[model samples]
Target: MNAELFLAPFLTGLGLAILLPLLGCYLRLRDEWLAALAYSHVAAAGALLALVGGLPPALGGIAAAGLAGAGKRLFARRLSGGASYALLLLGGWAVAVLLAANQPMAERLGHALFDGQLYFAGDAALWQVALGVPLALLLLRAMSRHLLLAHTYPDFFRIRGLRSWPTQTGFDLLAALVLALATMSLGVMGAFALVFVPTWLAFRRAARWRAGLLGALGIGVLAYVVAFGLALWLDQPFGPVLAGLLVLVGLLVA
Candidate 1:
């Protein structure tokens, strides 16, 4: 695969994994409406990227978007706190299984499910990164204020006549749609781990949002660079190498 395809995903993953949670953490603390809105934007971006880039990268993007939607619909609207997150978690597992069963989409889906040399197969990978990065950056900038509001005062937003339930409902639906499209590309693991791990680390270790973002980005870049070298050194598949790097970083820091 060309450098862009291999490099871009890693870079994009760094931005996304940390950004989503930071947004979530902020939203959880404040305006649920805005949080839901930011979440919606993420889903839209995923779908757009999936369509523009291809199938494999899209899968992961779409799945990440789907998680937000599932969270709002099946969990957030009816439950609170841990219960909502748990339900969404379960739904994610189920979605993954279903996605796996589609034989026609196996090659594309495999990239999401396993850590093999999935996306590292062609020149198309470069386009995947090129398309995803700008989209991610746009999402971050566009939703910045809204995300801040949503994470900091969710209940306050409801009280102020925001009609959070419907907003969340719409948010979930949009996210799911986007995720469906994105799943065609980067797959699930790339989508989920990239979005979660780095963000989690930044939150646990960094003192500020900027610090966390930088840290996560660094981790993402490092993980990919190391994975690339290791893959070459050991003559292993690229996907697993990248996946392993992510896991190793999490373990070392955790």
Candidate 2:
């Protein structure tokens, strides 16, 4: 086995383990976990389009998702509660499947699109992880007070005229960008697990937001290492292997 097989996934996992947990911690705290997953699927469809269209997959995906996210405020207003996001999630997924189903060549990208082609992650993917992880962390630290207030006092926030809508939109778009880039490494479902599972565990286990963030990062890294080892040992698919481990960890931690 080429060492790069392990090396690429390890680095991708490390980046996600750091970046996603910070976003997840905030999403978990704010009750917007579903929103992240919803846009990630949209990004996945965008990635698939990129694959078929011969564009840069991550960039194309990010652009498509950002456009959709920008309009989310208006779209969400038309639907009751959070159901609009559900629409986006389903739309993205269905379109991806439909497009892939028509093209015989889609199989080439399918393995990475659904199950994770972490081994094949290119230099572009690596760079995204390298740069994105730190930026995500910085975003979290800078917005701690604002995030705390928004989640804790949403109604009060509106009353205070705090100008949180732009901030909220910016965060939403940023999350879309990260997820789109992460999909280049982890694939769609693997990215979803990375985005949601550890944060779920952290939210349940830790008492404070900061503790939850730290605990989630710890859980994500541990799970990534363990799952990669198990996949290599068993010659199993990395995405499913890691996802199962994450699910089990979420259960155990809960």
Candidate 1 colliding pairs, count: 41
The alpha-carbon lDDT assigned to residue 147 of candidate 1 equals 48
lDDT of 1 by residue, 1-254 (tens): 45664554454343433334443333333323233333333433343344344544445445666666655555444676445544444554544444445434543444343443434434454454456545645555555554445556867766776555434454344434433332333343444444455656766888876676677666655665666567767877665666667788789989
Off by over 4 Å in 1: 1-75, 79-112, 121-125, 155-186
The CA lDDT at 135 in model 1 is 63
Q: Provide C-alpha RMSD values for all models, in order.
A: 6.9, 1.8
Error of 1 at 126 (Å): 3.9
CA lDDT, every prediction? 0.49, 0.77
**Distance (Å) between predicted and true CA of 18, model 1?**
8.9
Error of 1 at 216 (Å): 1.3
